[model samples]
Target: MASTGDTVQNLPVEEAVARGGVTEIEKGARDSTDELRHYQSSDFASLRDEIHKEITSRDVLLRKLEESVTRLSEDIAPVKDYVMAEMEEEDDDASSSSSDTPEDGAPQDGDQETEEERNIRALNRCVDVMMSLTEIRENNEEKTKKVRGFYEKIYKASPLTSLMLKFLERNGGVKVIIDCDSKDISNLVRGLANLDGEKCAGTTLHKFADFFECKVYLGGEAGKYQVWEGLKWVDKYHDPEASLSQSLAQMVMYLIFKNRGFPYKCDDDQCEKLYEKIAQEALQKMTSGAYMDYLINDALSMKTPLGREVSLISVVPGMLVKHGSQGGMRTLQEQVPFLTYFFMQHVIPKMRSIIN
Candidate 1:
């Protein structure tokens, strides 16, 4: 009962084929979309669950370390009490011996121990036992500190941390956002233009301006990061003439400290003060010409007692000079390795002190 026009064979060959192809293409697209949705829903959910479980495990481990430290503290309390008691008893005995004139006729009690003497002996034995336990408690406290520190390092290095950082950055939750200045952007564009030998530099600044949201302003060059000190926001700005190496070092140290629980912005007043102090110290050291002079004059030439050499200058690419300013002063690229090494060696210890 169907008309010949409804049948594919009766239609123009191209038209019939075109309609069939379009239907196939549409069906394929729908299938692909369905697969993508399923993959996202299932796989992403599973991944999130895995990350949650890992975070929970790390937290449990940290909690255990805290509990161990608490138990040690509790155990050490009795030792502290016993030590105090012994000190008081010794003082009392010293006073009694010094004040009491032995009655010449009194029976000498040296052969047999008096109740007080026996008590003192017992106290001494208890003190000995407590001292041993105190030692153990101290060792455990140290180990707990070490374990907690290791856990932090592991957590910071984990993929979850990477994911969290990415999420924060994308959501504009980052405490510090460094915007490239006009001069920097222009320089970058010119450099790129030189590489490409193109006229792309003309529109580069305009394109960058249009790309960012209207609320954002980009300018200035500083080797330091912005931090939060309690309710106050502290901007640690460095010299504008600072090298790229200095900026790289600053960023690296910031990330390292951030991972070590020294977040740039925080609500805790103590943390804010500590980080602010650290930030100021870091800025001073990084920008100090005196430090550079010291590194070149003293630190670089130092050798081990056995005559084996140990120096960061040796690791740099070019031949280093010990005498002239040309040899002493390094290029921007040359400064990267030594500056990074210097920050890691000097600043990291300060950061580590707060880890516990």
Candidate 2:
């Protein structure tokens, strides 16, 4: 945040914010010991001009490339037509010269068939390559346009999203929420989260927003995505027991305790043993309405953490049944054909990970 003599740069955001709002950087950090100069509007204008020139050049290049490819394709069309015509001629010649066809009226020479197939595959591959290049060029052009727009919009909208993205880029496993809509930034977050060691521990919300008690925040989501650290996701309908809102606090506490080496007022080993005992007791008590009546009402009222946990897990097996249209019970087991299919619809895996 320190400045060199006669050097200019964008004002640090903290200095701008502390000045009472996002204005008056000079007054905000006026008490600073280090010398500084405001980055002049003229300098930003010059930078803008330079960046615009670069984009213009790129657009021109892309336009030229597209035209050139079109022209090349046109020039190659005659050759392609000629090749196809020659292939047809060869096929006709083969049929005439080879042993007469039977009822099927087709030649069955294995050697001729193999040679023709090789030629066709080579020609098909060449066409496929051309098509692939065309698609790449088109997509690049579209993406370039979107990126340019994103840069413009980032400045026009809030800078909070950009700040979160940079933080998450350096430190993985965090996410954030922001009011702005920028595909470029959203895509960046997705790529980061998809990278190894970057995903959150659990919760389908996909990213972190400075959720309640997670981090400090200034403004609200303004109906935009709830971002975690830098990850973006839409909030969806979820039952309280199955939702991140209900579970994130537990995850936070667990992470805090775990990071501190599991320090607590009680024995960690006993905690595990207690959970095991509860699970055993719940299984022993499983029955119809065991999910709600026996386990939840009977076990939890025993007035202990051990009692509550065993009762909680007892509800899990009941989730496997989904109601039919006429209200008959059908199992998720028969409905989900694959592990992935089950994984998406079932909360058991997420619950298991978060609970433990």
Candidate 3:
């Protein structure tokens, strides 16, 4: 109100009044906005720090979990390996044990049978052997008995008949006598005869020769015949180198004489008697070199009648000859066929019969 300048100043005041408190209000609002922005920035910084810490903690936890997992795997791996190895070892041991076992469940291959089982097997074998032996013996005995009975019947029926005539007639006839005491005759006869007597004789000779050949030469009940004491005396006194024919003749004569009962002729007074003087001459001839030569040629050639190809030299006789060289000449004769046959047929059979 005083001048222009004062008027300008007043105008300004008036304008300010008109805007009412707009400028002050605007400034206050601006200051408050700035303060809010600053506060918001600080809050955001705190939030970011907290988030970083949380992330760092999470990372640490993850690392620890990984380490724990690694440690657990490491611990379990050895245990797993050990368990597997143990299982493998157990399997190996079981397999080995199974392989080593025997079929009988024993641990050794040489497992033996029980004693009772062995004894049972042995007993069975013994029974089998004994049964076989018994059968053989029974058959042999039956054959022997039949042969003996047939011979005894023949001998008893006609004691005085000629052997040849007896052989020709089947019924109530004389049986051929086998002088088994004559080794030379026996050997020659046995060589010629067959077991069945088929090839030994024929119709030309009459069935007598065949029958006689079988009974005397071949194996038969002739083995059961007893040599007369007279025939034995003839054998004891016969010539060493005598022919088989001569020896056989002597045997026949002895048999005839024995049957007739050698009788001495006497006078009516009975003061003087003349006895047959045949024995002394026969005894002188037996020990000569001729008899030894005959025995060597004939007796040594005899073979077993059983059809085995064995020679007398290959048999027990040969063994006896080898061992018995030191025995006396008389002892040797006793070992010959005649004595052997007598013992084997008569003495042994009687002894066996008694025992049975």
TM-score per candidate: 0.22, 0.19, 0.19
Alpha carbon lDDT of residue 199, candidate 2? 47
Task: Tell me which of candidates 1 and 3 scores higher on TM-score.
Answer: 1
Candidate 2 Cα RMSD after full superposition onto the native fold (Å): 30.1
Please say which candidate is ahead in lDDT: 1 or 3.
Answer: 1
lDDT tens readout by residue for model 3, 17-55: 786744666678889999999999999989999999988
Worst window of 10 by summed lDDT in candidate 1: 209-218
Q: Rank the candidates by lDDT, best first.
A: 1, 2, 3
Cα error, residue 187 of model 2, in Å, equals 7.9
Error of 3 at 77 (Å): 2.9
Error of 1 at 275 (Å): 15
Residue 232, candidate 3: Cα error in Å is 99
lDDT tens string, model 1, 253-309?
334344322233235575444334433333344456424432222223223311101
The lDDT per prediction is: 0.34, 0.33, 0.31
For lDDT, the strongest prediction is 1
Instruction: For model 1, name the residue pairs that clash.
Output: none
Best by TM-score: 1
